[model samples]
Target: MNPYKEIENEILNASHILITAHKSPDGDSVGSSLGLLHFIERLGKKAVIGHPDPAPEFLQWLEGIDSILYMERDGEVLKNHFQKADLIFCLDYNATDRVGPEMQQLLKSTSAKKIMIDHHLNPENFVDITVSATEVCSTAQLIYELIEQSGHADLLSEKIGTALYLGILTDTGSFRFPSVQPRTHEILGKLLGAGVSHHLIHEQLNDNNTVARLQLQGYAMSEKLEILDSCHAAIISLTEAELTRFKAQKGDTDGLANLALSIKGIRIAVCLYEKEGKIKMSFRSKGQENPVNILAEEHFDGGGHANASGGISELGMDATLKKLKTLLPVYYKSDK
Candidate 1:
């Protein structure tokens, strides 16, 4: 059977289901979860979203945001729901490990079937049903198709449209990323037709930044920024102390990678952040001149797209930055 058909069958049979995403959920994960939640509730089935932390206030405007259950280090409520769920919709991830150690244990212990819906490369084959279209821009687009396939298209309420639109908008970097497609624009038109307010969502997402965040951006530009190979590569690293000083939240580092790409001669951009004893790296490249995922996977055990990727490293700041300085030239030829 086709992947979409298989997922549709699973949804039809499931009575109680749990939907979740990776740790440090992004707009795609949170929006897709809420979009699915709205669609499921419209079907008269019981659906709930499990998130490790509260989504930022910018996203609180989406429907069913109030119903999300926040799970701590070892949340008993999430454990109970995981055990009772007939199925689990693992949205926007390739592996159960992405959900963190505690949630992974609950998932393994439960009898619920795992269904994966994602738009990432290198899918893990652990789930019972997998519907991954790496060519698609966002998981929200896939969820929209799932609803349409299941004959639930008309059930897409204004709430569902807004949530899904946020997923597409943020994942595509406000429609500036290369992933933005014509179909994405078509979907946006349909969403507006459904009464979803684009201006309000944009304002809520953009205007809610605190003064500390602005100061943090200034600090990053001043202290952390580095241009390598005569601006062929750019990098920024944020220490934990700097994050504390700036009151930087988990997703506050969202646009720092893009900042490097803004340089005229830059081909590759990297952002390294220290969090919980590990250095998290976000990489991006422009055009076809940079092999970003290869550099990340080889150096830091991470892989993503050519223009965007990420990985984690145990190598301390000085060492990691040293490695990036040396390795960047291997993948890119500087016009300088």
Candidate 2:
């Protein structure tokens, strides 16, 4: 049988299902998972939402956000649920590896049917059924497709629609990214018809930043940012001391890449934050560069989109910059 057909049939029949996404859940991951969980629960089935990391504070107001389980200290709850689940829906990520170490182990040992819905590139080998289409802007779009295909589109409650809408809207950078397509707009229209409050979602996400985060942004611009190589690239470093001084939190540095990309000729942007004796790096490309491959293969242990990627480094800021300076020359050799 076709894998999707089998997966759909399983979804329709399964009494117990668990929903999950990649670790360090983003808007798209959290939104898609919660939206689908709510939809499944409406059918009177048992649906449990499991997250290995804390969802961002700004998105916590969405329905079913409280149902999320962060298994950092106590992961056995997730292991128990994964073991008992009849079916598992993994969204927004291309691989089980991205789901973090603890969750991945539970997924591996479970007898539960694994179905993957994502818009990323080639998937890992773990999933039993995979529906990955790189053309789509966000996994929320894929969730819409699942609801449409299940003949349950009318059951899309306002809560579900709003959650899914946040996924699509934020992942596309409010429709400013190149990934936005006709289907994205169509889905947004449908979501609006379903009574999703657009203004509320925007305000909840965009305007919910704390004063400390705003101050961190100001300090980053004034002190820590460095434009390099004729302003084709830029780097912003945030030391732990600086984080303390500004009282910044984890999500505070989320959009720092966008700030550098706003510069006239800058094509690549990087934000490095020192956290817990490790440096966390976020990379973004505004032009024709694939930062994911660079970070994944060369510098860090992570990969994401061609234009946007992130990773973690063991080296300090000075050493990392020396390596980045040496490595980045390849991308600019022709221009030089």
TM-score, each model?
0.93, 0.94
- With a 3 Å backbone cut-off (N, CA, C), the pairs that clash in candidate 1 are none
lDDT of 2 by residue, 206-253 (tens): 888898899999999889888886537888999899999998765888
User: Which tens-of-lDDT digit does each residue in 67-96 have in candidate 1?
Assistant: 888677338888888888999999998877
- Model 1's alpha-carbon lDDT is 0.83
Alpha-carbon lDDT, every model:
0.83, 0.82
Clashes of each: 0, 0
Candidate 1 local Cα displacement, residue 217, angstroms: 0.3
Q: After superposition, how far is residue 221 of candidate 1 from its true place, in Å?
A: 0.9
Candidate 2, residue 275: CA error in Å? 1.3
The alpha-carbon RMSD values of the candidates against the true structure, listed in the order shown, are: 2.0, 2.0
